[model samples]
Target: MLIAAASTIVLAVVVWATVVNTEGWAAVQRFFLDPAIALEYLSKIWDGFLFNLQVLAISVVTVGAVALVIATLRTLRGPVFFPVRIAAAAYTDLFRGLPFVIVLYIVGYGIPTITNTRFPPIVLGVLAITLTYSAYVAEVIRAGIEAVHPSQRLAARALGLGYVQTLGRIVLPQAVRKIAPPLMNDFLSMQKDVGLVSILGAVDAVRAAQNAASQSYNFTPYIVAGVLFILLAIPTIRLTDWYTARLRDREQMGSIV
Candidate 1:
């Protein structure tokens, strides 16, 4: 079933590429082959690309920090943990339930309307992606934390280590290794989600391409944008696969030893 689905997707992509090449090749040539025209288009795209990178970097870091704190609180099992757990659950549900565009709108527009303070488009874009993806990262962190053996925690407690001490010293380190692959995947998703911020009038790569296409009445800029995204995403996907394989090999070696 998976093979069939994959084949279908490949076939569709090939057909789409064929159509684009046939119909859009003139625009592609005019936009890309003409040095002056290409440079002009590329300059606009460069600005957008920089903003996209900024948004991705800021969002990933913020999300990672927020996820770590929330995941830690969620993993703590006790009466004192109840409120944190509830808050975490609510956060995960609320963000995950909302679409990315809606989140961007709220952060970009809604907050400013209420507070009468303007937020930078890039800042709002980063906040939207961070808030949305943190829930997913929180789950990844929670799973990683749980993967640490109960015996390890008990042993830490027996050795006069407090909960925080044991978690920081032992549990989180182990959990990080287990969670690295998924966390990388989430970052890749965030990279793509940067395009969603374009809807909020943030001039991201996609938006720049859109403006170019609209002004030129040509599809080549959009195609260029797609290619750029693919170029960026391919490396991350390969790295994620490499890291996952490395982790698996280490696990196997330890088991054999």
Candidate 2:
């Protein structure tokens, strides 16, 4: 009964949207019919899109590497590990608490003012995202590392493996497998967060749409940008879902065995 009601509500929404949002519908139609215009808009945005991708890719890779190191250090038992863990915790808290837009502004505008050096917009974008997401990724990685069985750690120690060796050989490989889905989800999030770079006048896809909309005095370009983002997100969502299912299946099989 609830499902039926929800379906009815959704259908009603579709009908209402079609009826009320005539301009949006017309924009969609215009976008589809004018191949050259759409292509030109896309071309203008392509460089920005590529820059966004570059920022996401570089930030993810760099942040992942740093997070892995921090997670490993945090897992170790010692005075050294205590300070390292506290620092890692602080870093994660600081970035995660702050808004990304504020971070971008600080990096893009504030840093240059303080340091008397002008960082490129893309560089600032990368730094802001890396600083923000690295914290979350660190926690994700740390949880994954902790999820590994204590027995594995003890066994490795008994086999005369050093702390680093144990983590390198046993802990990380298993933890990485477990965290693969969450990590991919983070990548998807970062991809979307690339739009935040637009605030810094980075000329990314969203900015391109804004420019086109301003010049054309129509909303079609913005709609096209939304469609493009959806197109990118859908595949990542599917891949993450598939990976999560596979990991769950593996866990179940291991339990049975």
Among these predictions, the greatest lDDT belongs to 1
Residue runs of model 2 more than 4 Å from their true location after superposition:
1-37, 254-257
Put down candidate 1 lDDT per residue, 1-257, tens digits, no spaces: 99999999999999878966587876667754444544558878877888888888888789989988888878879898799899888998889899888888889899889999988888888888988999999999999999999999999999999989999998999999999998989888888889888977888889998898788766667766766778889999999999999988987885763
User: Which residue pairs in candidate 1 collide?
Assistant: none
Q: How does candidate 1 fare on TM-score? A: 0.84
TM-score of each: 0.84, 0.85
Estimate, for each residue in 1-257, the C-alpha lDDT of model 2 and write its tens digit.
99999999999999878864667766556644455556768777666677777787788778888777766666767785688778877888899899988898888889899999977887888888888888888889999999999999999999999988998899989999988888888888888998889988888888988898788766667766767777888998999999888878876885763
For all candidates, the clash counts are: 0, 0
At residue 170, give the lDDT of candidate 2. 91
Question: lDDT for every model?
Answer: 0.85, 0.82
